[model samples]
Target: MEPTTLTTDRLLLRPFEAKDVDAVHAACQDPEILRWIPVPEPYGREDAEEFVLRAAPGGWREDTMYSFGAFTKSGVLVGSMGLVRLAGLGGLERQAELGFWTAKEQRGRGYTVEAGRAVSDWAFTALGVERLEWVAEVGNEGSRAVAQRLGFVMEGIQRARIVQRGIRRDARIAALLPTDWERTMETPYLPARTD
Candidate 1:
């Protein structure tokens, strides 16, 4: 799958370019971003270059992930968001994991949420994704908040679901299904009887 671009009223979601390396490296410097996301502790220019020059393009070519750099309309890098670990493309199950991090100065605004919605819409419609999952370290309230605002139903916490910086951590898992996208029932859902 070729890398594509998405846009919201206030942002543009596009593929990373060589010119974005500096900005990407700078954003990854935020301790909060490093702590929550699985980026290197001391992110460097080389790491940034590799991401924009290799990983981002490789993922798209492999059809395993689709990453985007979120920028303000004026072209200032604001965040990064993507659908990773794409699965079941040729089978009955169709899903992907959503991940993102906002620049330190861009927090508290709704840009990330807006970009997430646009990406989700594209995943559901353009990519035929049936399930979009979001997982974050259990205590990362900001990430959880964005997922919640995007209508991902909090499923529960999974033990040792993530490993970051050499330590295993429990993660909060959530999902937004096709039905959830439209706020309508695709197939009737019934929970198991606990009685």
Candidate 2:
């Protein structure tokens, strides 16, 4: 499956390219990013290249993941977002796991929320997914805020669901079904900027 491009009011959510290594490395190097994600303590350019090159494309081929580079209108690499483990429990591919991260400088700008909403919209409408699930570490307040802003209902907390960097961590689970999106009209999402 080819990675698809999605758009929101101010974001161009597209697939990562080989040339994105530097920006990806920079994004992954942020202390907050390394703290939350299961990346090496000091993310190197090789890791970024391998992720954008090997892991990303392989996941697409296996129908396991869909990652997108979040860009602003002026083509700035502000972040990344994706769906992982996009398969069903009983051979029905209707569910997926959602994850996202933004550059340090891009935080508090609603970019992830906007891009995540766009990804959710595309997953439901274009990919025909029935539900999108989100899980973040218990203390990941930023991610939680984005999930809430995108209208995901917090289901509950799962004790030690995430094993990040060899450490067990609790997670908060949230979900959004297609019907839920259709029913909610005002989800507090930012309008995409066209300029």
Global lDDT scores for all candidate models:
0.91, 0.85
Task: Name the runs in model 2 displaced over 4 angstroms.
Answer: 89-93, 183-195
Positional deviation of residue 179's Cα in model 1 after best superposition, in angstroms: 0.7
lDDT of 1 by residue, 28-101 (tens): 99999989999877999999999989999999999878999999999999999999989986566678999999
lDDT of 2 at 25: 94
Stretch of 10 with least lDDT, candidate 1 = 182-191
lDDT of 1 at 146: 98
Question: Which candidate ranks first by TM-score, i.e. highest?
Answer: 1
Model 2 poorest ten-residue lDDT run: 182-191
Error of 1 at 137 (Å): 0.4
Indicate the TM-score of model 2.
0.89
